[model samples]
Target: MFKKLFLLILLLGLFNHTSHAQKRIGIYSLSTISSKSGHLFGLDSDYNGLFRAIPAYCVDYFSNNADFITIDRKNFQLIENEREIQKSESFMDGYVVGQGKSEGVDLICQSVFDVDTYSLIIKILDVKAEKVLCSSDKKMDKNLFGIKDLKQQVTGMLLEISSKCFENEIPVVRVLETKGKKARKVLIAAGSNLRLRSGYKIEIYELVNEKIGNKTISRKNTISSGEILKVEDENFSVLEIYEGNEKLLELLNNNTPLFCKPTTN
Candidate 1:
């Protein structure tokens, strides 16, 4: 009886863990075409190469930097090959979603690059939801120096779109250490990787769970706030507390469960 009970408990724990696992993202092959000159046949090799680099860079960026998401590279290759065959024709939304769902990915990242106007449109689709979560349409100067310059622009655009698409998955910045008599300065466990920059405001919060009449309500209560002083590295940053400094210090000293999120203001 005890062995059976232990196995049941272990099974439940595994189920819970699986339920909260990060979403898997698959990047499709970037489609390139000329808006004015008509199709792939009219595009030069340089333009095609530059456009193809977008999806490759996205796959690398998300795989290395996005800790809160998972990338299915094996399936991405399959989808990429299929899309490449259909590059000359327009692919329907239903087909894309179906492919993503069949591959077991939760989200799909797809883009279309117009070679003539140098316009790029990126879209993030939620496979299960069968809808676009967010999208960005950016135009670039055709006179850009070379492929490197175009790559830099594409990376910036992708970062912005990614931030919007996975805003909720942005990892919480934790107070790693503190300084100052009143703890006016703090070191957090996040930096440029979180897209944090000097002068960006961060709101500190403590998650609270309350039980009321057999139901549990969870919410984040803002306990303090700060402005970024410097991004020390990819894994750390310094923040100068501007609000509720004393309370923040108290929480820090007590080692309370605190987390911070970057604010738009």
Candidate 2:
């Protein structure tokens, strides 16, 4: 019927809107400390190659894996061109903010590699807020000695960055129903549409609020952990709790405001 068709169109529109609502991120070309120092000494060929490859790797990874983020490739190229013109790998914070705003991206990722200290520092900036959202500093592991080991170290650091930036994208579902007092299985309000898969771990938690002076702080207190047992449909999945079942059952019995999110691990 026309009514059903209209409803279907509306749902599609909403889904498209939600998909586009994801944050757009631009990654600048990797910078090096030696370049910032303006010294004649330059990084070795291997290090240079590694630095050049990192941004591409990041682009490919996000393009393939992230459903909740859009990569701003056009602006990324522009930024790289500007860097090449400047004949330097380093960019100032002001430049980063200006470029980020001009590109109209929600977030910007910048990395600085120290050739001397073997440290890779990554920073994610919020363009509208004009501030850093998160950052990570990683030093080459002592155990990792060769170029191959260095590549692995850098890859691990990049993965950490990805994890931090996309953390909010993890699907959150509400516990809809519980079997019984000793319930090990529960139904949730999310499934395949959220990219949830069987065996993916989930953590159940409740927000706890505590007052300190005139301020109230809220944090998640994990009550239980589970893994997806089945994806029944696009909007529902079943989980089997393997940890803290008693606490989870008590919370469900009392109808607590508990939420579940897929674990990054």
Q: Per model, how many backbone clashes are there? A: 0, 0
Output the worst ten-in-a-row residue range by lDDT, candidate 1: 74-83
Cα deviation at 33, candidate 2, in Å, is 9.4
Cα lDDT listed for each candidate: 0.67, 0.65
lDDT, candidate 1, 1-265, per-residue tens: 9999999999999877876675788877666666774454322345555676677767765666543364544224333344334333344456678888888888888776777676887888889989888887778644556443455456556655765776432333445455563667777776766456777777777778989999998777888887879899887888888888878888767878777766533
lDDT accuracy of residue 185 in candidate 2: 84
After best superposition, candidate 1 residue 126: deviation in angstroms? 1.4
TM-score for each prediction? 0.52, 0.53
> Per-residue lDDT tens digits of candidate 2, residues 1-265?
9999999999999988887877777866666665345432232334656667666655654554445364644224433334434444333656778888887788877776777777777788888987877877876555454444444445445544654666532333444445555667888876665555787777877878999999998777888888889989877889998888888878777878777766533
- Candidate 1 residue pairs in clash (backbone atoms < 3 Å): none
Regions more than 4 Å wrong, model 1: 1-19, 36-46, 65-69, 72-90, 141-144, 168-231, 237-265
Model 1 lDDT at residue 100: 85
